[model samples]
Target: MNTAVPLDAQSRRALLQRISDILLRPAPTWLRIDAEGTSAAQLYKNYLIYLAAIPALASFIGMSLVGVGAFGMRLRVPIAAGLVNLLVGYVLTLVMVYVMALIANALAPRFQGRRDMPSALKLVAYGATAGLLAGALGIVPALGMLAAVGGLYSIYLIYLGAPVLMKVPRERAVAYTAVLLLCGAVAGMLVGWLTALATPGAGLGQRGAATLRLPGTDIRIDAHSVGQASRRLQEAQREGDGGAATRAATDAIGAMLGARIDTGQMDQASRQLEQARARGDSEAAAEAAGSMVSAALGGKGLPPLSAQQLRAVTPEQFAGLPRTAIKAETNNVMGMAFTQVDARYSQQRQQVQLRLKDLGAAPALAMGMASWASSTSESEDEREIERSYKKAGVAFREKYRKDGSRSELSILLPTRVVLEASGSLPIDELKQALQPVVQQTTALARPPA
Candidate 1:
């Protein structure tokens, strides 16, 4: 069969139906059909290119139309930037498909499978049918979570196709699949890193010539001006110069205000400012000033840090903290590292809440005299490690409370990597309780020896 021919109307219909079967039917049937070799070029043309486009186009439309919903509010990406991201994501997917196929072919012999490039390509392309199709739901925004189910099913497809397409022995299929998945995980991380640098919405460290319109003024600020102003503010705060600090902070706040407003709206605001000034509308003037002050005080819809708090907070508290630890990109399973470990004594609760993240794989190392609160024999100990193909993690709880009452639990989820205990027990005790699970996760992250 000549798989090189471009897909026509009938061929396209047949191809779609075939993919439908691969998703719904047992792996044995799809593998048998896929084993009948198809050309890499034709496969890319007929399936990979179009299948990957489904999510890219869907995301573009979704962000442009429905937007991302968070806490009952719709947050939309700029259309131009969204389009750029969509195009970049689509191209990345195409490249990754080829890269994964090459990896599969290279790994085939190690698993005692035949080294067939065409089979490898088919394995990836056809195997991904479930995910690519389900990604179409991204257009709805809210239904984006459904795409994860498709991804899980794709993992099942990979497990099933490995023995048949890779020609690996049945006994070695699981081991072979695991290595293949590890390679994929690494590739995903690299792609995400590159994408972050390319897309320009919230990336902070780049210098650009674009100017931002201030809330109530005709003055436009450039990136260099913003940086200088921020540094001056920091210096003033450090020097304990209250007058200079206030002035510097005001400038930074004014420049940073109206971050969410677009260029057109900013122009409108400028016009409104002039009109209000001409009419002597003190109310409008006062409202604009309040917005500028709020934006300066962490009112930009993000976590706030006041001038006083900024002076007190230092990087020393969060030294050696990682932004992200274990993240399965395709699975959307991410564990963020803890930063700035802290503690506070709650008078009403009569307990010290020691806030922290996993401590360099040694949760119990510095913990002082806090013993394991829960014994495996304890009825409340119900500690069962949750392990699955998609995830492997644990949850730990302290056995004893200082108050001896579970009436109020001080839950600390600084990052997804967290330990919870609701007792008058010292903070170290809570850290100690979480040590086993953190240690287990560290072990799980290691490659099979």
Candidate 2:
């Protein structure tokens, strides 16, 4: 009787454990997509699209919980419309994706899974992460490059997640994803390049695709034509092609100024002349315009712009040179790194020059305009630091009052460069690169008179 009781007790314990295991088991997330019995190949494109939209879908869900109406706020149609568009996009993509999966399954025919659709959906969803990363890079304005990058990243996600999503082995999924992204990127780039080439006047007007895959590198470049054009304009600035640079700068500035004058417009022509003059480049631009007018009115064919006319371009040329040596150095470093980093800075500087392009009477750019703007007062901290060194007494320099006029544009830069210049040595080369305290101490004691 004891043996029988023990056996029964053991069985009961086993039964209880089994019940617990079943209860605790996690539910699978991939929904069986085709209970409605649609064929697989037809669902490919829609499925792919849905996967891309899911992140936005998840975000919308969270956002909806804020309940503006419950709080007595008026409804905004834009928010709802955007959400609906996203949702509809998601649904459509899912349908196409399922169709894509069926095509693959049919070709193989050895696929024995409870529901292949779930795995395919999951795979696409995973790939979407890579695309999202690429999208984040969309901030860099040159070609829809930022967006292209994000999209490219999504493809990588697809590649990385495919194995898990499709229930395929890692190697196979990676191979598939890699192949798809590579092919897609190439096709996309070729199409964009061809489209740009085909457009009128080398296609500077319509927006270019902002994202592109650089040859041999996974890095994405500008994709959209407009962004591409903007980047090109920006690039021309860095190269310092005076004529092209001015044209690019003016176009960008004009957009900001909302003046809407193209080079062809007489008013645009006049405004350009005015902008040059305003920057102290006015005299030079005027001379150049005068020379052009002279050539039209029968002067010796326009010689390289006279020295007088050249002055106008200088304001545009050195548009954003740093106010201090430190900023200059940092700016220089940003230019040196990345193959085109310098170009980026030049582009920015040109833009600054063209718009705020010339130095105003603002204290930041008041260096040349004023005889002596940098004279410092004998602050308490400066006195303490100086007195301590002279008397051999312990002392520390106190900080000065913050300058309200200081702005990102006006102030000196920090030590580090966002991008390290190519071929820079780690060893200390500059005094600034050395320990800050040491530099600070040295700075406290003035150099030989």
Candidate 3:
């Protein structure tokens, strides 16, 4: 077993550069490796130990500060528990990489490749660069999908490395890569099982976060709110209100990034406002106040509606359904309210959701539905609602009238009205149930108010 000088500074730097090259330029990168005199111990000491630490540290920080955001909610893990999970997962990943290298050696002979143990180690260690570096993505839980995408790219690295490191023929490289991948998968599951056994509480992706709660008014925020604020800030900037624009931009960034974002600038802005007020500078004081309001509440605050506005947004009703079948719907979003009336039923293991949102929220809801309906992947069978209304679409499933099939219908009516009906029902029955509602809603929508 040959080894490089343990304390050589240049070797350490070379290791870091190699990790970067493998991650960024993997296609030609693998062909450049010498793969000579590489051994399991040397690989582990020089590369695996150092490179694998990136994910562990990343996960620890990600879990502690910016936890996962999914299904319209955010979850955070305790720092102590996140640290433990990180350490355990780190050890497991290191072991998994080594085990995959051994598996590569075992599969090499079938592909007519030379039985070189050092080369196999190089293949596994370097091929994992994309996935290893993607650990930093976990810090922003919303970007986890990007990390998964990065991991998928690592498969290509493995494919490219097979021929260079394993000496497999080009035609046999894919097969060799596939078999080794299968082995890695089995090894991963086995290692995970063992890790779970050893650490009872530190299961992968599990965190001790609080239960999901409906966001309170002015408390809960997400990426959408941040984006809205950014647009508002840009508008303010365009209007030459520099102080207001700066305040709006900061609030927007803080909402999207996290509340833990530094507030020193915001504090400074507040101080400037106070100083201006003390000096009897009314214009500066008013500008500062505008900035503070912009930061505190973007776009007139949550739900962006008022009780008077809700009252003015009239409801649409269905004529065929019994009065008993119809119900008024109100969603109290963080104290911001959106009201509508709906008609629904359950039969034959199927359900229907027929809703009419009022003027206040209808246009936005219609836009969202229209966007989904127009998507190429949503459903193949889509068509215009009717000659009367232009901005509407209906997507139907195959055999939609059959017992288990489904369909979705959306129409943007006049006066900012939105009509939506979705269900799994016989196509004839769904049409019958929806026609009267559509007709009534459309009739009301077509006439000028």
* CA lDDT scores, all candidates in order: 0.48, 0.30, 0.52
* Top candidate (lDDT): 3
Cα deviation at 323, candidate 3, in Å, is 28
- Count of clashes, each model: 2, 58, 2
Model with the higher TM-score, candidate 1 or 3: 1
Over 4 Å off in model 1, which ranges? Answer: 1-8, 70-73, 201-449
CA displacement after TM-score superposition, residue 33 of candidate 2 (Å): 6.8
Per-residue lDDT tens digits for candidate 1, residues 90-143, read 777777777777878898897679898888888877777766777787797754
* lDDT for each residue of candidate 2 in 1-449, tens digit (9 for 90 to 100): 01112226665574344323211110111122212333334323323332244334533443443322211322332556546633543443343333434433332222122236545544443334334333322222222222322332233334334444455454343323333332333344554455345432322322322223211112222233224345655576467665665465444322221112222332233345455656778465665444322221122211121222212222222222331111111111101111111211224222111111111111111111111112221223321211001112211111222331111111111211111111121112211222332233223321122
What's the TM-score of each model vs. the native? Answer: 0.45, 0.26, 0.44
The list of candidate 3 runs beyond 4 A from truth reads 1-9, 70-74, 201-449
TM-score of 3: 0.44
- List the candidate numbers ranked by TM-score, top first: 1, 3, 2
